[model samples]
Target chain A: MASLKNIVGGELKGYTELLQDARQEALNRMIDQAKQLGANAVVNVRFSTSSVAQGAAELYVYGTAVRLG
Target chain B: MFDSISIVIFGVLFIVGYLAGTINEKRHYKSIKKREEKLLSLPAISMKRLESSDGITKSELVSESVVVSIDYFKRALAILKVLIGGSVGPYESLIDRARREAVLRMKESAPGAAIIINVRVETSTIGNAANSKGAVGSVEALAYGTAVWK
Candidate 1:
């Protein structure tokens, strides 16, 4: 079975294309992690972020962590 | 005789100090309340225009508004007035009111339209200690979201 994948821009982008670059990078990381799991697809994915450090930004990518049928 | 004299003096001094402290607290409470009220009355808005997904035809306007930025300084001092607890701290209530008011405004502003996802709440502070301690502090709240009508 083949896996499905999806990604949406993070809120920090705020109508600007520049920050989208960072979001894309985060998404790429998620895609690579999924591929490493030998999964054909990612589904029900979601994104969240927080200021892990006083002046730093942390982006999180979470999904079902599923296996394809 | 000497012991009684010392006791009387100590009692008088303690009473005076207590009275002074109470007066200061009252003044502080008044100032804080005025600041909170000013912030609550301020108007804030978030606006969005929805057109055809392909960027054609007219646009629809949606707005959300509320009093915003109520922090340690802007929240009512009534709670502190009790020297412990009171019926104040409307931070959550303020947010709820703003959301409701904005939805109502949107309903009136644009009828027969479904607002899109991505509703946003933004807060900003105004009059951040503009002058003296007696000055009133203010804040503004805005709501942002998309509107889609077919």
Candidate 2:
């Protein structure tokens, strides 16, 4: 048996109305990457956001892809 | 001479900021309370399992994010707090409201779901730096969870 580890990220900026879009994009991207690695589910998810510049911020979400039964 | 003038100017500005900030904070808190009452049942709980997954018809993710600006008075107080090594009370309430509002918005997004599980809120301060007077800081709160629709 073997275990693997990797990290991925996404970014977006706009009105508060569209903020969720960015968050989902980041999360979905992480899920997609995990699925590519053939993981069952993601665990220990951690979400982070930071300012890229004035009036704009970027959301970064990550998690450990795992196989659970 | 120049220092005294600058001091007076800042003092007056501080007074104005304090007055406006107090009023704004009060109004915001009032609104938060009202909405919180409406959302009392839709808790953004951290528990991974909200209810029995047995009868769950479907599952999906729900997320909400909000950004709020810190008033000048709070910013000034935060500066003083940095120097005195104390907590910035105003910023704390701002963060509190942001998180609640984010959760409330999440509930709105998942209208079919009654409760969300594994909920978490993340915050970020949008500014030039953690401690900077050059720009007004804005706090962004993001809340997400797994919603089971039955």
Candidate 3:
């Protein structure tokens, strides 16, 4: 499986599954962006988050955009 | 009189150097964190959870271990244009070098494998906190790669 990291970091509360859901949400957005850009894979992925802002805040996701088979 | 003047000058230079080094260290730390944050926010090309053993996995069956190390310095540069302070170079290199060594070991152990999926790189602090400036932080890089015969 190819790995990736989102470009932002923030406080995530609740359980692991919830965090995973949020991560998936961000991943889906990233995949959509990649698909639009005609890229198949992303590598050297990293993740980051900002300090906790609010109960609901923004999550930034990014990765090394790549084309894969 | 001349000796006194030289001592004063040396002291001033020392203080200046220390201050400059501290400022640079802070900048480097911020930059590293920023880059990490940016990398983490993006959607992943793919995500999977692997087991030491169990149900079959997705993608192809390529048993390989790939170790990747990210220098907080390089990461800092990528995130922010900050030249890390002096002492950090060696530690960062150490972490990277260790990762490289581990990767090579993986290669040696697992031959005939093009890549190592479910790759995980672990990092730990090497020295005492007093010795390392705040720039010294431990990191572990994990990734899954496909080992295709090339």
* Predicted structure with the largest TM-score when compared to the true one: 2
Across A1-69, the per-residue lDDT of candidate 2 in tens digits comes to 000000000011244556667777988899999999999898768788878887577888888899878
After superposing all C-alphas onto the true structure, candidate 2 shows an RMSD in angstroms of: 9.6
**Can you write out model 1's per-residue Cα lDDT over B1-150, one digit (the tens) per residue?**
999997886565445434543453345446545644544422223333333366333333244333322222223232254457564443344344434444444344554454443445444332333112322222233343444554
What lDDT does candidate 1 reach at residue B44?
26
Give the residue spans of candidate 3 off by over 4 A. A1-13, B1-150
Residue B86's lDDT in candidate 2: 73
Task: Encode model 3's per-residue lDDT on A1-69: one tens digit a residue.
Answer: 101111111111222234336646876898799888999786554433332432232334577678866
User: B1-150 in candidate 2: lDDT tens per residue?
Assistant: 999999997787667667766776678678778888987776667997754567788777777787666655667777788788877786688788788778888888887776788988888875555347555356678888887677
RMSD of each: 17.2, 9.6, 15.7
TM-score of chain B of each: 0.41, 0.84, 0.32
Identify the candidate with maximal DockQ.
2
lDDT of 3 by residue, B4-63 (tens): 997886566445534543454455456555654544422222224433434333333221
Candidate 1 at B128: error in angstroms?
A: 2.2
Listed in order, the DockQ scores are: 0.02, 0.14, 0.02
- Poorly placed runs, candidate 2 (over 4 Å): A1-21, A31-45, A50-58, A64-69, B1-12
